[model samples]
Target: MAQKSAVAARAPKKKASSWQKRDWVAAYIFIAPVTLGLLVFYIWPFFQNIWFSFNDVNKFNMSTFVGLENYIKLFSDKEVWKAFGNSLKYVVITVPAGLFLSIFIAALMNAKIRGKSIYRTLYFLPSVTMSAAVAMVWKWIYNEQMGILNTAIKAAGGSGHAWLTSPSTALYCIMLVGLWMTVGYNMIILLAGMQGISVTYYEAAALDGAGPIQQFFKITIPMLTPTIFFVLITSIISGFQVFDTIYMMIGKTNPAYDDTQTVVMLFYRQAFDYGYKGYAAAISLFIFIVIMIVTVIQLIGQKKWVNYD
Candidate 1:
């Protein structure tokens, strides 16, 4: 009887039920498209880019292994360094300004106000608008002669200056457009974070004789730090890759083009205009490195300010 009991205890476990197998199969089927897309579009291209960076690729699509030549050239390239500096400048200017503006707008919108949905829709419209269209409209608005901006300036007893044509102002002009485009989206994200905070905290602070400003600093900001961190990281990443606005607003012929050209713009010019695909690939890798380093630094710094609780 003891031997039989031991045998029964050691009996093979039952196979997984048919229902479990079917569930797994169904999940795989549901995810197949996205998995395949990532493999083909992102994973394959990423490896190919790395391979191309080490080779000299001609217009015929033939490659000759040149090893670190492209990378070495990048260090001495004046245009490359200028582009990098411009990209960093854009990030420095836009990220903080955008963050603060979004938070301020979100705080205002979070208050009990009339036509809140209308205001949100109006603000978010710029985010949904096509980039190309936004560029065209802003181009008209920044036109040196007839733009409304210049018109307004002249009407105010001030001289009108070329916003997109002058080297001193072109990059900053593009940065303003970028800020206008992004602020609404970031504001909505912050508003969601604001709404998620429990009213109890604010009520408790109010009972403690905390005014609105005091409650905002003491209760709202601490809880919103996580969302702020997320927005900050994403903004930095996007700001570093600024290209379209510069490309559209400051074309190659424009005198301000050099002042405003970003790293991606340099890549575009190298790959297509100059037909140096390998060099372009190297430039892309450099951009990837910059973004990764910045992201890592922000991640490390977040622990000081981000409140996961």
Candidate 2:
């Protein structure tokens, strides 16, 4: 009996049936299109861009191996540094302001207020609006002579300065528009996170004699950290890549163009306008590296504050 039991234990397991094999094939078939799409559109282009950065690519797509010449030029370009500074400033200013406004608006929307759904819809409309349209409207609103803002200032016995043309204010004006465009979307995201928190936590806080404000500070904020982290990362990335509004609102001939130009704008000018594709590729890689470092830092830092529980 012991010998028979030992032989049974040593026997080989049965192979998977034809039906199981068919199921595996079907799963791969379902996923193959998506995998191929990513490889063709995303993965291949990424490696191609990296290769372009190491060569001298002209407007005609002709490339010659340059051995980091493009990268060396990138480091020495004053305009590149200026554009990077502008982008860094944009991120530093917009991220905090946008976060505060988004949190405040989301908190208000989360309250038991009247017609909040309508209010939410109204606030969200700008987020869905075309970015070019938004930029054009703001450009009109900031017109030096005929803008409503100037008219209001003139009517109030105050002088109107050129808001979008002055180097001192142009970047800030763009930051304002960015904040307006993004706050609604961030609020919606934070609102969803706020709604996901359990009612039991609030009830428990109330039983402990905590007021609404206290409950908010104690429960809502902690529970909402994960969403806040997500918003911060996305906002920083968007702030760094600000291009459409700047392009549409500020022309190359504009006096404030240098003040408001971000790194992506510089890359656009080099790649398309100036026909230095290889140098532009290097700039693009720099932007990618900066974003990656920032994201990695955020990921590491989130361990201290982002409360998943």
Please list the C-alpha lDDT of all candidates, in the order they appear.
0.93, 0.95
Cα lDDT of model 1 by residue, 196-289, tens digit: 9999999998889999999999889988988999999999999988877777777789988899999999999999999999999999999999
TM-score of 2: 0.93
lDDT of candidate 2 over 110-166, digit per residue (tens) = 999999999999889999999999999999999999999999999999999899999
lDDT of 2 at 45: 86
Off by over 4 Å in 2: 1-16, 306-309
Q: Give lDDT: candidate 2, residue 90.
A: 94
Candidate 1: deviation at residue 258, Å? 0.4
Worst 10 residues of 1 by lDDT: 300-309
Which candidate achieves the best lDDT against the true structure?
2
List candidate 1 segments past 4 Å from native: 1-14, 306-309
